[model samples]
Target chain A: MLVNRVKELRAKYNLTQGELAKKIGVTRQTIVSLEKGSYTPSLLLAMNIAEVFNEPIEKIFIKREEEE
Target chain B: MRLYITVILRTLLYISLAIMVYDFVRIEQQFELLGRGYIDSFSVNVGNQVGQVFIVITIILVIMNVFQLFVMKRNKRAKVEDYILPEYDASDERSVEITGKAVRFAFVFILLYSFLILGSYMFVPNYFLDFVWYPMFTTASIPIIGLIVYLISFKIIYSR
Candidate 1:
């Protein structure tokens, strides 16, 4: 299972899903899908999102317990 | 992705049609030369050269079109799979096999053609090979070869 830091990181920066999606060059629905654990970002996309949060990728997105 | 493949194949068909029309005109010119009392073998040689060259070009274009289809399909599938199933890596073994089969089929076809030509040289001395044979054989076989290639590539690209 995948865990997306989208909601938490977006809230930390006081940004809406649309705003976060615009920053990452993807559609709003892509952000929505990511947060809902229905999609996984490519390596480049994940890296871009991590940079937006000013944190390492591991901090924003953690694997679920079942996945571990 | 399917739309992209259809467009590419249609373009290839148009190009092949143009090449065939050009070859037909050239063949008529060769026939005119023969009517003017040229050496008996002159038209045959010229016809053979032009026909073979045209067939080879058409085959090359067809192969290129096939490659384009593969790349387009692969890109679209990769994108969709990335969104839907991140853990599973797409298997490319079928694609590899299809490529191998296409190459092998091409080799076998050429080998058989060569054997037939050599046999005509030995046993059927009176039956002369004409220039039209190349284009006729190629035009006829393109569909056969294309069907085989499409089947293999389809199995490879879509199986997984």
Candidate 2:
């Protein structure tokens, strides 16, 4: 599973889901999915999101071990 | 200007769909008139031909609108700014994935349903065979059923 600090960082930056999504060339639903951990974005999308947040990709996204 | 173009494209799409519905109704009415002996066979045939032409035109309009919508979405993405655009990327990866899953599920469902339908024809051949267009109707229904299933599954999956 991929964990993300997108929601946290978005909140810190006072950006709404739609705002963040538009800045990254994605839909608001994509941001919602990423925040909810329901969808794993491609490397390009992750990098774009990181750029939008002005942070490193590793800082925004982390891989978590699957829970049995 | 871009927003107006999007609105115009949407309006055209709706108008084309409306025309399709109108043509379908006209065809159905012509068929009914023929059955009631109100219209001759030649008139019915002409009505069907016209309806077919309208259908083709509607299909072309739909395709054009879809292409325009895609272009509009790409433009919006390229010009992303503080303001939120009303456009959506219908062919996004997540949407495509969900649609693929829905299509596969619908295909399996339709296959099983077809088997059941075919099996029923064996026992009630007379009932099913009474309609000369039974096979055609069933064949046409496959895509409709698939579309319904796709929409339902998409709703369910996306809700999560």
Candidate 3:
């Protein structure tokens, strides 16, 4: 599974979901899904998110083993 | 201007759908009346012709409206970098995921429902055919049920 610190980074940047979504050219619901871990974003989206937060991709997203 | 066009197209689409439904209901009523020996054959033919015209116009309008919607979405996404877009051809990934899940759920629901109907028919062969309108009602309800199932599932899945 891919886990992400999107919510944390979004908060650090003091950006609402709508603002972040607009900056990244996505709907606000996508950001909500990303934070809730219900949707796995593409690598390009991950890079865009990293770019917005000025963080490394690895720092923003982590790959972990699935829990049984 | 784009929003205005979209709104107009949507309104027209709804009007076309309403007209089609009205036409269908009228034709069905005529058929029922004919079966009861109340309507003449010439009247039935005229009603069918009117229904056919409405069906053709509605189908054309639906196709045009869908094309317009696709164009509008593509234009909106054109502002974003091409490389940044998702793998799917649509506007966003999340919408695609939600749609995918919803369609899967609806497909399964329809499949199960059809199987149940088939199973019931094996025991009572004449049950469905006894009512002339039953098949039409079932056919019409499939899409409605699918849409309802999709909306409910989408809400539950996305709200979490």
lDDT of 3 by residue, B54-77 (tens): 566556656655665556466554
Candidate 3 lDDT tens digits, A1-68: 99999999888889999999998877898898899887899888898999999999999899999999
- Model 3 lDDT vs. the true structure? 0.65
Q: What is candidate 1's local distance difference test score? A: 0.56
Could you give the candidate ranking by TM-score, starting with the highest? 2, 3, 1
Q: Estimate each model's TM-score.
A: 0.33, 0.65, 0.64
Candidate 1: residue pairs that collide: none
Docking class of 3: acceptable
Better of 1 and 3 by DockQ: 3
lDDT of 1 by residue, B1-160 (tens): 4323443444455445545665675567567767886635444323445446556655765675565555546554343332121111222322333344555655676567656655654553443234434444445454445444544544443333
Q: Model 2 over residues B87-132: C-alpha lDDT tens digits?
A: 2224355654565576678788888878776776566566522443
Q: Report the number of the highest-lDDT candidate.
A: 3
List runs of model 1 lying over 4 Å from the truth: A7-18, A26-39, A42-44, A65-68, B1-160
How does residue B128 of candidate 3 score in lDDT? 34
Residue pairs that clash (backbone atoms under 3 angstroms), model 3: none
